[model samples]
Target: MSQQIPFVDYLVLGENPHLVANECAACGARFFDRRNACAACGATGFRKAQVATAGEVRAFTIVTVAAPGVPVPFVAATIDCEGTSVKANLVKVTPDPEHVKLGMKVRLATHSLGTDSAGTEAIGFGFEPLETAIDGQ
Candidate 1:
């Protein structure tokens, strides 16, 4: 896999860093990373697309193992957007698996995707329960 990099100033069209992916104009399939050709139909038709900013949690898993740059017992999930589904880590949720489940309505939240000591930033999306958005009052 390639290192995470920023290809555009606006990560996603709407606001607060929407999870941006790409859809094939030929087959109408969505995939990550900007592509020049459709992976499904081999057509030179593609455009930048963004996933639904809010969706329900289709599945979830907790990571108790440690790895580079990732903390132990972190939560991850398969978030089902309006139509397309993408796997992403859940942010601002309970660090416990018992507290998460399928069909939980989760909202999109932005995170510092990645960072280098030199101060470069990469912005990506995460999931936050709707109440978290309101509780920061």
Candidate 2:
């Protein structure tokens, strides 16, 4: 069996997959990457904060152009997970204006992105419509 690993360090894969962010101790600002100082308050302290699994679409664009071998016509969206803004792809839904809209509820989801020569599988995360998540479709 191959070992599965998250494509990003912030993604936690298990029974319940979720993302963790680096929160500024002083200003409550959250970031996905490590920061020596908080951009909001210039605080040097940080803590690990778990991001909400559910969020609403704040903005999105249907990308029809991409690098070679990459799929086109995918929905790239900015999700507001609680108060944190998350940039991810909308999966399991048609990448059309009629199908995707602002304020659409969504939740975290993961999929396998094949494996490497070392037999290690990489898992990538995305957001899907909340209705589909609830209906298990």
Candidate 3:
């Protein structure tokens, strides 16, 4: 069996790959990373919270340049998953303003970044346009 590893620490991979966030128990504020204390309430209590896979694009930008070999014109967006905002790349469609729009519905999608000669695969996650975009509403 090929071994798999997450691209980031908060990403959980398996049959249902999902992202986890640190949710402040006191104020219910969520953060993508571990926090020393709640930014809203200054509470030290927190819990591992599973974020919803579906979200709406709040903002986005078209990238025309990136590191070597990386594709250009990709849509980098800030998505609101439930209540938490997540920054991720938008995939599965043309990366343009006409196609990728603000408030577009999207779903979490995962892909294999690449594999090593040792048969280990690196997993990556992104958001893709969902059925809600079909009518272009």
Residues 34-136 of candidate 3 have per-residue lDDT tens digits of 7999988999999999999999999999999999999787988999999989999987868877888888999998889999999999999999899734545
Which portions of model 2 show Cα errors greater than 4 Å?
A: none
Q: Which ten residues in a row have the lowest lDDT in candidate 3?
A: 128-137
- Which numbered prediction scores highest in TM-score against the true structure? 2
**Residue 98 shift from truth in candidate 2, angstroms:** 0.7
* Model 3 bad stretches (over 4 Å): 132-137
Candidate 1, residues 1-137: lDDT per residue as tens digits?
23444435335633355766787877888877667787778888777777778888888888888778777777788888897787777888777857787888878776666677766666676788766777871
* lDDT of candidates 1 onward, in order: 0.74, 0.97, 0.90
Candidate number with the higher lDDT (1 or 3) = 3
Q: What are the TM-scores, per candidate, against the unseen true structure?
A: 0.74, 0.98, 0.91
Higher-scoring candidate on lDDT, 2 or 3:
2
Clashes of 3: 0
